[model samples]
Target: MSATRDLHDLGQSLWLDNITRDMLGDGTLAAHISDRDVTGLTSNPTIFEHAVAAGDAYDGSIRASVEAGKDGEGAFFDLALEDITRAADLFRPIHDKTDGVDGFVSLEVSPQLVRDTAATLAQAKELHARGDRPNLFIKIPGTPEGLPAIEEAIFAGIPVNVTLLFDAKQYLAAADAYLRGIERRVEAGLNPQVASVASIFISRWDVAVKDSAPEGYKNRLGIAVVQQAYVAYLELVASARVQRLLNEGARPQRALWASTGTKDPEASDTLYIEAFASPLTVNTMPEKTLIAFADHGKVGEPLARDGGDSEQVLAAFEAAGIGVDALAERLQQEGADAFQKSWDSLLEQIATKSQALTA
Candidate 1:
């Protein structure tokens, strides 16, 4: 069996962190679902930006949106919605069979609204409703300002994939927001069964510390960070608060490892995927990584719930003068800014493409 199937059997979800109109039209995405055990997918401004800018696949749709009096962000969403909803439909069976535990496709709000609590909430609701798919998750950044929006969005009955989290603390904060939303729902006599996932980016930590670390520490920080986060996740789900919520029919916001593609040439292509394998978590990987993993990946024993050796590994980094707490905050901010830059470029691309297709 393919290693992808092994990971699936191990109960770690493998979601493709990519989407494109061409992939959908060409049966590639469907094949990944059927053949590679990819139960879900995720999209960001960067992914959509690349999709729209890459080929003539989107040209006809861009022209139609332009002719229909849409441009810029509006045109982009119209295009994105079409692709996401279609992907959502393709995964609907897994979604139904798993009873909402898997088979989700995430669509993020404009990164420009990351700091705007009210606007973020509004757009999240709008996008969730617009998509009208049960398995769709409207992604909101896990920034401070975004926490309230996340709470509000979840309370309002929208499933959220909280993004931009860099470490365990950030993941906890996102979890708090999700739980608060569920608690509020229970208080208001509403269904507290809203599904959510807190996405903790994995590879970026290694990238951030690669230059300053010793040879022994290279490409290890990210896995250690995720291991630590997994400990926290295990604790959170086992806590009385979360257990109570679970009894009340609320779902736990699962830990999701994102940014999992190896950025280092010397590293194993499946570096993050192999080390971060644990049940009850999601690993959303790039297309290259997914294909690489299926081709030659190996799954080891699952991560230790107690975070074996993670503290010791992190202590080595700390001894090397890496302040992990501060670094997490910086990475989160940098991630948001990078997404915002991509969002801006995406809008510009839509506008430019709209004109080109129309002219």
Candidate 2:
């Protein structure tokens, strides 16, 4: 069996971290779903930016939107939604088969609203309503301001993929917001089955501390952090509060591992996928990494629910003068900033394309 099938059989979800019109039109995404067992997908501003800039697929759409007097972000989202809705439809079968537990496609709200809670909530709701797909998740950052919006969106029955989380603390905070929203629904005598996922980014930790950590610790930070988070996730599900909600028909928010693409050339290309193979968690990998894993990946023992050796490894980092708390905050900020930069570039690309096509 292919390693991708191995991972799926191990109960870990392998989602593609990309989407494009060509992939959809050419049966590439469908082939992955059929052959590689890919169950879900994720998209961000950067992904859309690349998709728009790389091909003539979006040019006609952008030109039409421009003629209709839409430009910049407005024009871009129309094109993005066109692709996402189609992808969502393709995954709708698995979505129904799994009863909404898997087979999700995520669309991120504009990063420009990262700090604006009100606007973020509005856009999330608008996009969720516009897409009108049950399997679609509107991604919201896990920033301080975004937590409230996450809760609001969840309470309103919209599935959310909470992005930009860096550590266990951030992950728990996002989870808390999700629980709060569900608890509210329970109190109001509403169904609490609104699904959500807290996306904790991996790989960035190793990238952040590679030069600073000693040789032995160079590529180990990211996995250790994920292990720690997974432990916390297990504990939370077993907690009395969460258990109470579970009894009331509410589901625990699943933790998803994002940014799994390996950044270090010397490290194993499947480093994150192999190290963090835990059940009930989603790992969205880039296309290259997914292909690499399907070709030569080895499925190792699953991640320990008890977080074996994670505390010890974290302590080692502390001893080496690495302040994890401070670094987490820094990384989240950097991630938000990077998305904003990408969003700006994407809008610029749309303008350039629109003008050329219209002329």
lDDT of all predictions:
0.93, 0.93
What RMSD value applies to candidate 1?
A: 0.9
- What TM-scores do the predictions have? 0.99, 0.99
Shift in Å, residue 54, candidate 1: 0.7
Q: What are the per-model numbers of colliding residue pairs?
A: 0, 0
lDDT of 2 by residue, 45-104 (tens): 999999988889998889889988999988988999999999999999999999989999
lDDT of 2: 0.93
Q: What ranges in model 2 sit over 4 Å off?
A: none
lDDT of model 1 at position 308: 85
For residue 121, what is the lDDT in candidate 1?
Answer: 97
Give model 2's clash tally: 0
lDDT of 1 by residue, 82-155 (tens): 99999999999999999999999999999989889999999999999999999999999999999999999999
